[model samples]
Target: MSGIVDLTLTYTNDVAGFSKEASKVLDVDGWNASTLTFYSHCGTHMDAPIHFNVSNQTIDEIPVSNFVGKAWVIDARHVGSKGLIKPEHIHQDIKDKFVAGDGLIFWTGWSKYVNTPKYRDELPRISEALALWCIDKKVKMIGVEPPSVADVNNLDEVTKIHQILLKGVVIIEGLTNIDALQTNCVELIALPLKIESGDGAPARVIAIEKYL
Candidate 1:
C-alpha cells in the first residue's frame, strides 16, 4: 500500500435523486433551507441485512468494528469488462495471508464509470465460488469499486450473492478513487452515517497503507 485512498464518492442532489419519485429536497412553507434526502443504498453506501429482508437489522444495529479493519487489495484488472472475479482471480498467496476478519477490497479498474449507466451495466461481478470463498474465509467485509458485486440486470444472481456475503461480512459498494492505492495490505476505516434503524447509509471510506 502507498498513501491514503478514498473509496467513496461525492454525494450530490443533482446526480440521481433519492428514488424515482421522492423529492431530494424538502421545501418548507416559505423558507429556502437546503434539504436533501436519499435512500440507504445511495452513493458509496453500505448494505445492511434489512436492506434485503424486512425482518433484518438496520444500519445502526451494525457493529462499528465491522466497518474498520485490515484489508487485502486484490488486483484483477487483467480480467476486463464483464469479467467474473472468481476465486481464481485471487492469488493463492494472498488467500493464504488473509486473517479471519480481514477486509477484502477488489480492484478491477471498473470504477472509472461512476455516473454513467455503463458503470452499473458492465461491472465486474463476484461469482458464487468467490462469494462462498469469502464466507469460508471468515472475511469481515468486502468492498468493491463498482455499484455491486452482482450484475445489475440479474436480480437472481444479485440476491444470491448479497445473501451469502451479507449473512456475515459487511458489503461496501460504489467506491471510487481506489486505483490511487497501491496493491497491498492497508488499514481501512469505513464508518457509515449512524442512521438509527436504517437499512443502510452512505459511508466515508479511507485507507492508510502500512509502511513495511
Candidate 2:
C-alpha cells in the first residue's frame, strides 16, 4: 500500500453537551487521563439499521468484514450546495465500475464547511432515486462528507432515505479529507465502536492506497 489516508473528522468539545475533560492530571501527582463524553453519532460515524429501523440490526451485530472493503470515491463536486445528487450525476463510467458489495463514497467538497453553519444548512443530499439506485446495485455501504445523506430539514424525507439504504447497506456520515485521497479506488477500513445493541457509534475510517 502506498499509505493510509485518514477520512475521519476530528472530535472536539466545541458542540454543546459533548465534552472532553481531564479526569486526572499528571501535574496533580497522578496519572494523566482524559475523559471523553459525546454522542454516539457525533463526528465521523457509522449508522446501523437501528438508527432508522428500531427492529433491525445494531452496529455491534454487524459482521467485522462488512467494515472493510473496496471503495470507490465518486466525484460530485459539481453539485451545488443544497443541491440534489441525482442518478445522472453519476456518470456511466462510474456506474460501470460498480460491483456487488463495494463501498461507495461521494466527494462533493462539502467537508470544507465542517464547523460552519452552512455545513448543516447547505449540504448537498442524495436524491431518493439515486439512493434506490445504489441499493439496487447491491452496494455494501455508502459514505459522504456531509453530516447526512438526506435532507435534514425534511424529517419525513430523511426517514425515508435512511430506511431505504439501511435495509441492507451501512451509512457513514461526517467524513472529512476526502479531497486528499489520491485515487478514486482504495481499500476502505471503517470500524465502529462495538456498542452492544447501540444504534450507532463514531468510527475511525481510513483509506489505504495499495501501490502493487
Q: Candidate 2, clashing residue pairs?
A: none
Give stretches of model 1 more than 4 Å off: 18-33
Each candidate: what lDDT?
0.82, 0.86
lDDT of 1 at 98: 82
What digit string (tens of lDDT, one per residue) describes model 2 on residues 1-212? 38789999888876433689889989895789989987987778999989988356999999998898988888999997998998888768877987999988899999888778888788899899988988898888788998889888889988998988888788899898988889888888899999999899989999998722
* lDDT of model 2 at position 43: 79
- Cα-based TM-score, every candidate: 0.87, 0.95
After the best TM-score superposition of candidate 2, give how far the Cα of residue 14 lies from its true spot, in angstroms: 2.1
Give the Å error, residue 136, model 1: 0.5
Best model number under TM-score: 2
Task: At residue 129, give the lDDT of candidate 1.
Answer: 95
